[model samples]
Target: MSSSWYRDDTAPPPPLAGEGWGEGVSTSDNPQEERTLSRIASDDAMRPPPQAGEVKTARGQMSRVLRAPLLLALALAATPAHAFIAYVSNEKSNTVSVIDTDSWTVTKTIKVGQRPRGIEFTRDGKFVMVAVGDDDTIQVIDVKTQAVMDSLPSGPDPELFAQDAAGKTLYVANENDNTVTVIDLEKRARLGDIQVGVEPEGMTISPDGKTLINTSETTNMAHFIDTTSRQIVANVLVDARPRFAEFKHDSSELWVSSEIGGTVSVIDPRKHEVIGKVTFEIPGLRKEAIQPVGIGMTRDDKTAFVALGPANRIAVVDVATRKVTKYLLVGQRVWHMAFTPDEKYLLTTNGVSNDVSVIDVAAQKVIKTIQVGELPWGITIAP
Candidate 1:
């Protein structure tokens, strides 16, 4: 096994129970209360004015009435605005952990084919598709029932995949065959295959849905393909063992993570060139342990978050400067990450620790750790 794979190949412990399902912790005992008083005009049409002796009692009742709605508004604001479901793929245990974002707990453990990885929610949010490499197929999980319902025809040993903006077409990187298989999502049938480099691992599509990218680990290159012809248009060499690729929302830049090189390559999509690189450094840790595998960027393209595989930290990066702003310590062997629909919280899967770390985006702080399945590899949150 390659030195990088050795770290992930070690026997993982049994899947841990999803615990710590407690109420949201409050930082302060009392929240800031706001009082909004309604105009109380004296009107003979409704009722006569209060007597002088009862004025004080009437004022007290009015105070209580105004405070009630303010308190109710505060309670509603403190609750989570949205409840998003997150699916985590467990590589070793052959299962998926379904987490409810509102409660911050795993509601279900879904048993699936062997070696599940590269999970994503469909555009319609009705189903979740997961690549089970060992089983040589992609399985579909029904969102409502929380069960495996069907399978897709993927190339041999499908690893990572990407779908078009419309979610009608799927491109899967088949590691064993050195090819990318195209599947018709609506029909649930295989369309064709596009040849790529050896051991293709990472997959992504552009925002306009005109181009597709597949990164090869063994070949150490990113192959850009045109969606119209399903042919490679350009090849750009990157650092060693590129494992994941991500594109900006505007399609201006592409980011590829090299696991063994311990760096993230920033590429210009228009020029198809490496424009910059984002590196990570943690005190007292060797460079070899800081292997970056997954990346997540904000919708506005201002900030980015990268998962350093064995370093047990998530590097926060400034997109404009291409510099690491801070490294937040997390669980062991962090693999992948996903953001909630509103981008308030970012969840990361930790393989060795068998848990996921929840980060409050605006605060840049690790807020919660949720225990999940064994060797959690990939994660996807509902839109």
Candidate 2:
């Protein structure tokens, strides 16, 4: 008879039962017992000991992974569905164009006073106010109805205005009078006027809403006015034909762009001195074409975009270094630009082209252009 090695139910049989066919055979163990023992040993090795702490940790990690998607879904649901609206003032047409930001389409055309140059929205986003230079008044429009609601008592040839953060006060720049008319938005009446330089065009308020800056065109100076006292605090001389003024996000510096001078002056608001100047020189571009008109700075104060009117382009400037990085081609006679609420898009009014160019800020390119009335100039985004 032949003998073979086998395992028992509890454990492996001590050793092979047979050697040299029969002489060392163990008669006590059977094949069935050896097989059962082998099976038991295999089960012991495969079974894992339960660990309570490790199981709890694993459960927590899985729950966190599952929550990430749910949180993302909630955030997406909370985001606004509708895009912001932009108001564009058409100089020749004496009309305003309402743009739906989501579709980049013009939704309505509202008639306003003659020579509407500067346009802005109330901080509360309830009304759209426009400065009609020829009409010498500020026309207020109801955003929902797309109709003229009322008019504010602005000084002669009201060109531009700036609103405080609280949306309570508005400072209007009268080009002909060379004065800024202060108005209370709540009352819809003019409070008083502060004398500025010749041809006050661009107006802006500091972040704190304590100081107001007005740029004079022919006088070539930025006049700083204290909002509370309504007095001219500082007058910083700049280049020829200073058109637009913008304050840095932190209100640490002020940027004034000169149209005829083709340069930008960076001024220290506290010291009222020119800290640096930004200039551009591109081959084949005529010096006269690079007339800077509107100025805009990013929220972080890292970048600045200057509109070149005759050049039909925008110059991107590095705020920290005060250097012109690149020039982006835009519509014809690009005048002013208003950034969207999300700061993803920049819509610029093309005066000569009779259209508005939508620029993708991240891509730094014009993605779409929508035709507007003749001589589209001032632009503002509704709150």
Candidate 3:
């Protein structure tokens, strides 16, 4: 196990859980209250914006050419600052690399706790959260400032987590203890914990925020926990070593990726059963190389992208038919992926090759390969 795609292979797995995404801590009591959007944001949000109707008047039109530059100057002066960013967690390096998506370069390197894997941004897009399993905490980073500001309490070996739609609570999957840790985002308090299968790893909340799903790696099952009751309502058996979970925009189906199963399991959210399975086959590639781990789908649910661990390729699946339509070759051991808010591009973390592959969503092809930190495990993009 000297070079396994997953960590914790030296010893017997502590049980399974899915805590993907990256970042390291915020301790401020008012963390949420301090979030600010990127510029194009006004110098002062309270200031009134220029009315477009005023520009339609005859007198306004006469002066429009002269006022155009002045208006642009004012707007530029009012710009506070923000950018589309991608956060990548390097397991071996124990740090998070912040990439400016526009520039496609590493802008900052953040020192985090040991074993930072799963990461995501808050609902408000103000802060990025990274699960530090060794520290038993989730660190928060300020988006505008690009600094580690605070942290929230997490369960043992917190590898993956999910937050409510309202951004009120966070549900964490604790790998070592076979439980899901719950935290109040506002209060930064430990709300509770939910018992799940052995070695629970994958975690994701539904689109409507009614159901929270956690997949246990060893149990080979996805456990659906109701957000309100904090109890497991249904358990659907999946393929082996389920590592990640994603839901479609309409919340009709939940996609679960089994790293060792070589297939993507589609579960019906309402009935809580395996409705379909997506399998991939590369002509010259062996079956074991096509182990699926991360999943990303278009907003319209027309296409789905699954990251094949050792295959060095991403399988594009037709969402409607659950069929493999294409395979785009990428860097070695591609793991997690995230799309730009506009859905123009998708970024995948190539772990073994120590870089990231940028794919053009419209063309369904990799456009660029960016050099990142060592063993870039999980990645997420911020608006």
Candidate 4:
């Protein structure tokens, strides 16, 4: 595909007319479908589980994939208070594109530091934080102006970061320094740094605000840090190349995706132990290509989505049983993802394909693909 295919614009060229990139047109909405969705939402299991102690559940999950997108509009209507604007970091393009979910279009693009990767919106939704690895600093973007307002003093080669519940403290993973840099978000100054295993890449804080977690890529372990003391209280070793760590909303489990290991290590947050490991299998793809990177789970924690990087698919895992449910084919080299505020939609960054794939949360299908900058990576939505 030509470089022109990746652009920050209102829309890409006509789908059929364009060269090779593919995107789905929005499906027509039916007003009467609201009642039907309500009944589906109320069901104990919208689709029946295969059987008790079933080792494989792909057949049942594949059947539900097509019908999931149809239910999201109704889910959004049920809770109308939360609407979000999504921001995506473009590593090669050195820019961040603002996406308007209502229209599913790129509304604006702001220039930023080179090699921008990890990005997130502040707790108050007033700002966006982007880690520019090459620049060795994290830039702050004002949500109202959509421009770079300031930069935080992150340690060398800062790749990812996590903030506290009150949004007052920031824990940054400095890949080059082998340490997690702590900063005071309010003061915009460095507080201190905690030395950790080499190549620290992922950072996430617990939902209850009691713990902060960092995953070192080379160490293959998730280091649990106590928020108050800023110490590595426990280290739970996981698969190789643990790139991203996420805490379940309920605080019961922490999921880490290992790109090279081709598995997701499911850890019990309370015990700092690996309870189970989730693996993926795609019929035609080689085992080496099944590199899992990003993860997203529903508020109920019933459904978990893992992005299989080079496999070009997202594996749906059953939360209760810790088994692979199904794999939904997406664009190339899928990297990171974020859910709409209402949890009705999930948008994932496809790096090699140079676009963002949208998944309808309820239907569990890739409903749409939006054109973004080259190597679209990190994504976060306003609260």
Highest lDDT: give the candidate number: 1
Cα error, candidate 2, residue 40 (Å): 52
State the lDDT of candidate 3 residue by residue for 1-383, as single tens digits: 12211112255443234311112232222322222222222344464666876445677556644554465566556654345789998877888899987678899999888888989988777788999888889988777777777888988989988888787789999999999999988778898889999998899888888899999999999998988898899999999999999999999999999999988999999998898999989998888878999999999999999999889999999999999999999999999899988888899999999999999999998999998888888888875
Give the per-residue lDDT digits (tens) of candidate 4, residues 189-208.
89999999999998899999
Candidate 1 lDDT by residue in tens digits, 264-372? 9999988999999998889899999999999999999999999999999999999999999999999999999999989999999999999999999999999999999
Better of 1 and 3 by lDDT: 1
- Which order, best to worst by lDDT? 1, 4, 2, 3
Q: Each prediction's TM-score against the native?
A: 0.82, 0.79, 0.79, 0.79
2 or 4, greater by lDDT: 4
User: Scored by Cα lDDT, where does model 3 land?
Assistant: 0.84
Model 3: which ten-residue window has the lowest total lDDT?
Answer: 19-28
Q: Model 1 lDDT vs. the true structure?
A: 0.89
How many clashes would you count in candidate 4? 3
Per-candidate count of clashing residue pairs (backbone under 3 Å): 0, 8, 25, 3
lDDT of 3 at 202: 90
RMSD each, Å: 11.5, 23.6, 13.2, 16.9
How accurate locally, in lDDT, is each candidate? 0.89, 0.85, 0.84, 0.86
List the pairs of residues colliding in candidate 2. Answer: 7-34, 7-35, 8-33, 8-34, 8-36, 8-37, 9-36, 9-37
**Evaluation by TM-score, superior candidate among 2 and 4:** 2
